[model samples]
Target chain A: MSNGARNPNRWLAFSASIAVVALTAACSSGGTTASPDTGTGDGGSDGDVVLEFAQWWEPELPDGVLRGLMDEFEAENPGITVELLSGPYASTKEQVVAGAASGTMSDVVGLDGAWVSDFVQQGAIADLSALMDDAGYDQTQLASQVQLDGSTYMVPVVNFAYMLFSNDAMLADAGVDVPSTRSEFADAAAALTSGNTTGWILPLSLEAPNGIQNDVMSWVWASGGSMLDNGQPDVTNDDVKSAVEFIVDLDSAGVIAPGAATLKEQDKVEEFTNGRVGMMISSLAHINTIRESNPDLEFTISALPAADGYSGERGTPYASWGIGVAENSEHKAEAWKLIDFLMSESSNAQLADAANAFPGNTTARPEFVDNDPIFQEAFDVWQAGYPANEFVGLPVAEQLMRDFSEQLQRVLAGEISVDEALENAQAAWTDEF
Target chain B: MTATLTPEVEAADRQPTPPSSRVRLRRLWDRLTPFGFLSPTLILLIILMVTPIAMVVGYSLMDRVITAPESNFVGFENYVEVLTDPVFATAVKNTIYFAGVSVVAHFVLGMGFALMLNSPILSHRLKAVFRTIYILPWLFTIAIVAVLWRMLLSPNGIVNYLVTTFGFTESSVEWLSDPNLALHAVTFINIWSGYPFFMISLLAGLQGIPRDLYEAARIDRAGPIKQFLHVTLPQLKPIVISMALLDFIWTTQQFALIWMTTGGGPINRTEMVSTYTYKLAFATYDFSVASAAAVIVLVLSMVLAFFYVRHQKSRD
Candidate 1:
């Protein structure tokens, strides 16, 4: 053949090889698929069923109670299988949202407490009132915990409160006592702060909306302010302005960790675990993690305190993670069965103990806490607690919460005054709504 | 020819019998076969690129939320909302600042490294070692780079430790937390991660330059600066412009690095358009607004690319 004909053949071979290499690289780097069965099993026996469950807790507690319950459930109902989907907690919500968009949401999902309403409003989750009644579960008790707008949606798995955790040694070394009021708290924080050690830390980073919402709202709630007055953001309230001013004062006083503005929940816990920080406002879910990391560190817990001259009762932020069925799930029956198993007394007790969290079931809490003095005290404080913030049911809740966080950060950074920050936040809330 | 009138002679005298239609078609097939082999790539590009762009355009005009099935023809309302959002303005401002600083820094640092490596006084062994070292950051995934830098730039981290230990500064710098410094800090990380691409690319461009031009410049009594200006830069202009344009697009769309490090934080000081769109779509489930933002970014990039291509054609 002439060179002209031969050249085309060479180019063809080159292109083919390049295409093959590109495809191979893509396949190698892309995500792994679990099984051919997405929701339902390949046409099996008439009784066969497969249910996909997506939860973030798997990575945190892979071999713990939830896994055990699944095993038990599978054994109890032969020919039924559970497929678990999990990833880093940070990516869980995004993953679920994507799954919803693609119509591949799991039969059941473990959703954040703040996210349940958003999911329900989007029709991503199914109303479980009928399922709850069929299972003989007390809807009134569980529904109040998981329902939105008088409809059952979630079956709570773990209930916990956000409160203050202090490193005892740091406080003792600084000669400060446990604070019970906002003024005393500020004074204690200032007294405890020393060279190379901060007195307090919270996840002030705007990226951690949950952390920012919970930690900042504690101050707001304690000062006779609520994030929502009649389900609308009350950022311009006098009490909220005072709360913002107090936080700004703390930052100006240099009592917060140097990088507090960018810290995440895990970062704050890490600092406390390392025994470098005096105090942290965190949740009970991290107690096991902190203890596991620093076995020798001494720490104490306290109920969130109120602002000076405030007559309101002491309260904390209560939050939970719950299981719910997807609205479009093909295996809704099997999913409900799994949810029933998880919320059962035995499973609740087992999970609460293994996961180091309070049980969602009102009666199960006493058993779950089970004579642990730390949890007993937390339970008492939690009984008076409320939703951390009112953004839970608002439109564009996450963005609203983020905007609130950003304004607060601006105040802390001394770039804006408390009034200006509140005004800006309120403007954003108004625009978004 | 007139004397050779026999059948066999006539057959030889005439042009060899034209190949049958099948043979002619086979030759034509052979000529077109390369493009046939390229069809897979062409199809893949259409599927991944063309389809997504079309979808974004379609979605940008609708009032669609990913979680809900309800949608309506909004017709530019999403775009108006996105443009009017105060946060969107912040995002646009940040993106421009980041892209401007990052691209210029990458070019300067990358060209410097490429020139140093391309120097004749340096032994090939040393040059190879230095080249490898400079390119190492590019080899890492952005996730790894973000996490590494986050740790290094933490208040109590190695960067602070070194500064304080050496008495360079009296206090920790909160590099990722300071409102004024966070955007610059993220830009610095991006510069660190990105300069190596330019280095490798410009180095290849440098190597392709004919030695005669430099020799001629030297003979003309041209100084190092003069030689670089007259010979090196003129040759590198096309490459430099193309790379700079691409870097603008890539840096503006950067997310994982900034997301993992500062998260557009310290009061949205480092909020880029990409992260803002991401937050809108994922956090707020407002896909329509997010799609509008994405379409705007796409148009900006396409406009830059179009100008570059036109310039190149004009030059050619």
Candidate 2:
């Protein structure tokens, strides 16, 4: 055959190849393209302003509660519409970080205290102090604001404290009351240990190493101990070392849960819900989850036990659902208006009630606390102790936690002494700073 | 037409005609047709692979990136930092162990299963059931495999329950937690999930083996073992080498399974190069160092690919 006779076949092959390439590219692109409605608030039809609010709290709260609040905000402010972009915490963090890096962050964002410093360093989030002032917001009403270099980048909208949760039936079965001191706590934990049950469940997984900040550091914070001295890592200080040693002692006593090195927070909660553990240091945010998972499980919430003979005011470890306006947002005013509404006393109270958390406004109190005895107890614990979390606003906070957790695991495994572990962690943290 | 031409006339006739633009264009088109066919793939490779690799190399030589607005060029400092880090060293060692053990185990398990499936004594229906059962692990996504293995290997999970029930130990075994067992446990899971690919390939190879060779061996009074050692192995040698090399390359770059299961934890006991690079980039926001680690991993992967290509070429 002449070469010209084969041209159609060659053309067919070329077209087929091109089509495959196009199809592959389309498939691999996936869901990365943003829809016009969700696109970073470039004004909707007919001069209406669209503000994208990205957060992780929507999934945690009762379904449609956040959307209802946003609808209310839109009703009050006619020209502004709020869009909710929500996902699980990790994915939200990833999306926000990617957005920040690409200069396409949403108008408003939910902030974690651990992420605040990094965002501030990247200039990803707006300085809310000026925005609040410009909007005539009552700054004094805010319970707390995460600040870096004296500029408030994020304001807490709701708060959840990490407290000691005890399975009441297990404690009663073991004939141990809620322990309020270190020695008593250790004794109670040991007494509660039996077949298929441990006294305490510690999730030390390096994947989500906040277990170190929440579970291990809660011991230090309870007695007003600090992992930082003047904004620098002081992890090798006596208080931190002592806390590590205490955890090692508990591990030695076999009261801490097995497989802790791989267990995550959800796993700890599951063990507690399944009645496999007697106690756990858990967030108040998990209260509803625990109840939903095991309605019959009787549990009590209380302030973590302090070191003996340390009769000073205790510090409760707390995490918050913080709010911030993105630096790249075009509708900053509208974003601030939404933030102001969310931080208002009534709205904050409603949100807190729905989330089973504390209102971020100082004057706001969720009505549920008055009716639920457990919530009342948690409120009392909050009132009696100051919220403390030293890792908050620290640079590379999660990495620091991972470093400390790795060293702590080494100590627990008897590969290193407590002192050595602390020193190693200190060295690792020092490099980060 | 039969009249003889002078030398000058023949030379003039032999001289090429001054072609029209259409003819010249067709000639050019002919020359460009092959490149036209290859253009789509070349463009995709340049965009998807080459660009990203070049960017990573550039980032590796910078002081900071992504998180920092202003990044400074630093000559090989990030590489020096990563190479000197003790965790990086541990990651390299663990990656070698994890991949090496996984590849070897995959080959053994795959060969055993393939042999069973290819056995003449096995009924067709029974062989089909066995094949399905053996390939079930490979059907699961990496995420599902990680989660399933995590549940099975938990201290309070079924595996531990069985171990304790059988009086193997007085208490639950921490398969994924204990530093001593975590690397091996994850490697075992990798092996379980990976062997099916090799099994399928080897089964095809086994089926393609000529019956004449086995009959010849039998004529020579060869036993089953001797036939397998001689005719079967010789027939499967090229495929075996190719599959093993490819599996080794893929296994060494494993990230999802390790990330979902262990996160390279228990004091870096299970840390691999992928996890190390991930943590540097995402956890610490140290893109520069992460890029350096990534480039190192890329180089290692390229070396493995090199061996694979060389083997395939030699076989061809």
Candidate 3:
């Protein structure tokens, strides 16, 4: 910081600090559920305890409904007021990393179950075993949420299982019945497949392409393939390769979208919603968003289209979101209170009413499943035992997903073979790891 | 200066102590005040700019998160990995292409607008009205700009609607979906949002030029194109060059608009250096590699700047 260069940056930092302070105040004000007792006969201006909550569900969720709940929680507690901070899903990992390093983490955080390992590795999150016990949450369910290191950092909220959804009218219009077996599925897809319509729409957008992969797993598991063998990376495994080859051949058959390689994530949603496609391997959670977009469209939900080499046991990963306490929080007790409330039956029911999500608690799942037809199918998938194993490779895994997608795009664009694309994914994952 | 006329009698003994010492002290104060005034700013800059940059540079050289706190220092491993990576190479090429093409297009369109507004044939009132309207896009916050563009360029958006109505195309084009078109689509918005700054600047530059220079040129048989090449361009040189520099930097690091509209997709054919760096650092949390990418950005920008400044020096 020489004399000449120092001044401009100083101004930028000062301005940034002032802006952050103002933003903090604005954020804090939004969560002020007025405490009934704090307003009178108290020496303190506001409650001394300031609870903190962090979540990665913003932008997707409707504006601040969860925050409103927190405010009410605060108002109910005379000596406590909760403050909520939000980060987008993509940045949630980084926020925790940076926030932890800088000692600025909120008292409580919301995270995806897949990220539990990374958080544990970095020591960025804390074990919530005691936190769960205090609330009387189920231990087996809590253990399922724990990382490989045996620490339960996540208080699981939303339970997501991917399922195959069909545009029933489109299939009827195309004179094709909903397919059950691999052969039937292929035939049905071929009949409906056209320039304007693909037999199926699945996003191959390498990053967060989990929904499509989850559906694709139907064939993989059906073909007796496994993504990993006994909780280990197994890219070179025979069953996995055979399963991948099935999709590759279908890709060659032109049953998917022409621009599938270049399609945006939202494009897939629109394709399904706008009746441009007949089937999509999508989330049961997205049913409401799609249904709301086109209420008149008749749709169906079913288990993954059956494939050859069927194994009765399904292979899947839990795509769950959870809540946790921030390690450095000054108001840990209050945060725990809010977490407990949100975990309770009433709050869980409210959450189900607000959005379509399977609550992770065995007791709460019934409330969430009753709301939508698609979610019922999701529950069936869960019953079929398509267990979502812990996400392997972590930070490297995300990079690999992106890299794999880019290579897949090339294949989709007619620039390469599917075999080569898989090879590239292997290489990319190896290099990253 | 004889000691107040020998004190005019003893009553005028102390005539403010011959004020020259005060004057010298005042001169010293004047010379040093700027640094004092600027000290607060300097300290802030060190904390924000210099320190963070240094930290990034250090992290760039490390293997990062693997052995992190205890990891032995490995110089340039991250940089070497990234520079050799095909993904990063594509990102670099795309970023360079974006900066080069957008800056040039901005200059031409901006200069054209400035000339149009400078025209004396238009009434002053009309010019002012058009000027105000032209700057509306520029005044909008970037998020607003992105939302507006998303609507205008969507598969069923207004642009495709207009094209269909005019019979220019048979169907709606997903303008930002095609790999070939996504970069251009993002660039189009960048240009739309950027050109006005250059236009406003060049117009002001045009205002400063003597109107009589054009009059003299006309008398000397110069046409509009000829006058532009000889007179207007020469006079607008400083602003044009400076605007070009600014455009290059701003467009290179652009993220928010692209994030909102595209998310670096259509298979990342829309990838730029800054966005790629962000995805690596924040989205993926690969700190060492992301820090490497950022350091590359800084080095490349500095090199580009050096060349531009050198060219300017040579010209001078």
Candidate 4:
């Protein structure tokens, strides 16, 4: 045998050795577990702390604003440093969920009401009321606390009410007034439907089926009705049935936008921004997005149209930017300080103004409400109608919305009767509970 | 002093002496050489693949995993729950339809385009241009493909405009929202995005086919159709079977495109096993049930893989 054959084997062995070394080096460099004691008392021997604050809020706010706020907090608390880990809402939720499962959650975390119950169940979030008591923070100053089994797990940092948005030009062209009642709203929508445009946009994409909560159930809530009776699924009740019937009627009238079953919230906002739709029920958070997308588009804000002949204070659908302290965090006191700073009247107002939302502190009022008439009108609407979102703090809330949306899609498609659809939804929601 | 060695010493030197320690060590190293080359891959597979799979299997047999502090083994209860759900049934049916139709369409389109690109009459430049256009969809990431198709298939999108302009329809058609059309619409999108992969593979296979065979067929008075049926297909059979099986495995696991476009909506018309499992895990936080569903999907994939391996071995 030639010595060359033996040489090749030697070379192969050498290459394998090099590869093993490289792989070991790479693994050593990349394999970093998030420190369990990241926010603990022993985080630094010098009595300094580094708090990881994971949120979706920073990305949504104007660039540098959230970072600036964190900088201010760090300046005020000399020994404490805050780190911001931010991403879009969906990715943030996924990250937080993974972190919670692994016991590596950020010390201070952004929360959604839908996630509160699950987090509470897992004991992933700390009891905010207890922390507040330890910190001597006034709980009464907070607008609302999301409680699970009488323990506060999340506190609202800001609130965004979903309200009806009407394109002024479209409404004017259709000669329809801003709809205050369901019947008039349908008529206005019908009138607006002409020449490649629809009257209303309802996004019911099951991917993010908050539409069932924000768009469909808003009508039920507007009539001061509940989709739950004593914290159980009441989707088959008269209020929900009426709401579904109203939506089906709209579908039959062809006043609702086409492809609504596949449409998402951003798509609805786009349609409204383009003036392709006459009206939609949307969040106050989208106000700036619309203005940025189409500055020339004239629009007005109003309360969601109430069910006709329901003479009572309407309930407006609202979503919030909620804050919590991770239970795994050893620096619960430090985490609460961050929350307290954010929930302070001035800071909350500043955040709300920048985000075009309502302050979570009861006495805090966003400055945008004074100068922005549309915001003012929305604020007034919010005041007239108490914020109503029954799905909040419910177990598997998003799943509940999805179940309802799936059944509602069937109703809209005329594949099943409204009664049957509601019954099906009720059964599904019951199973989750 | 030139002392002469004794016959006994000479004989001892000639004996094997039970092989030296150095020789034994070399032999042992020779035996372990192949494993040394394979150790990195084996370690990776064990860590990345085997461990996660084992954990998921463990989760499949438990209740309230990942969410609850303490979980109890429920045997196959989670699996039973998932299997009995009507939505799971719908997901299975839809996944079959999606993968079946996608694979068939992908093969047909791919083979057709490959044949066209391989035609001798076409100039090389023309073929290059056509190839670029055909392969464009494959170049895009799945996310981009999904978003592009979404825009094109929107109710008021250009597709609708063209259809209406050509008098194919009276008004804008709801391609994605209509339950009847949504499954077909998404399958069409998948087919569009996936065919390029097959086309590229089959094109290579076509170029590798012996030109002398075709010339011999021509001399034998074999028509183009007969040549294709008798010669072309047989020549590409191995590649075709391999590509189709791989595509089936991939299409069955399609999640991103479906998730981005329809999200298994319009009354569960486009639900696939991937999306259903995802919903169970993420949307409802039912990790136990999701793991069970995942295990079921793994079994199905393993079965497909078994046949694929069998086919490859037969070809070899």
The CA lDDT at A220 in model 2 is: 95
What are the models' TM-scores?
Answer: 0.87, 0.92, 0.80, 0.92
Task: Show model 1 residue runs off by greater than 4 Å.
Answer: A1-47, A62-64, A140-144, A222-225, A309-313, A365-368, A371-373, A383-389, B1-39, B165-169, B308-316
**Deviation from native of the Cα of residue A14 in model 1, angstroms:** 26
Question: What does the lDDT read for residue A149 in candidate 1?
Answer: 83
lDDT (Cα atoms) of all candidates against the true structure: 0.78, 0.88, 0.67, 0.89
Q: For residue B135, give model 3's deviation from the true position in Å.
A: 3.9
lDDT of 2 by residue, A68-126 (tens): 99999999999998888988898888788888877888899999999988988888889
Q: Give a tens-digit lDDT track for model 3, residues A256-331.
A: 6544543455667788898877887666667878879999988887666655546466554446667776665655
Model 1 per-residue lDDT tens digits across residues B196-311:
99999999999999999999999999999999999999999999997897687677778878778887898889999978988888777788999999888766765665555555
Candidate number with greatest TM-score: 2
DockQ, all candidates in order: 0.29, 0.31, 0.22, 0.31
TM for candidate 4 is: 0.92
Question: What does candidate 2 score on TM?
Answer: 0.92
Q: Tens digits of per-residue lDDT for model 1 on A1-433?
A: 8875867754454444334323322332324233233342232457577788888878777365566778899999887887787776666676677666766677888877667777877788888887766766665434235667887787767766678888888888878888878888898889888887887886767676666567777787755577667776678987777777777788888888888768888898898899778888888888888878988888888877678887766556756677888887877777888877777677776777776677765556445455777777776676755445454445666677788888888777777788888899999888776
Q: Candidate 4 has which clashing residue pairs, if any?
A: none
Candidates sorted by lDDT, descending order? 4, 2, 1, 3
| Residue runs of model 4 more than 4 Å from their true location after superposition | A1-47, B1-30
Give the TM-score of chain A, superposed on the true chain A, for all candidates in the order listed.
0.86, 0.92, 0.78, 0.91
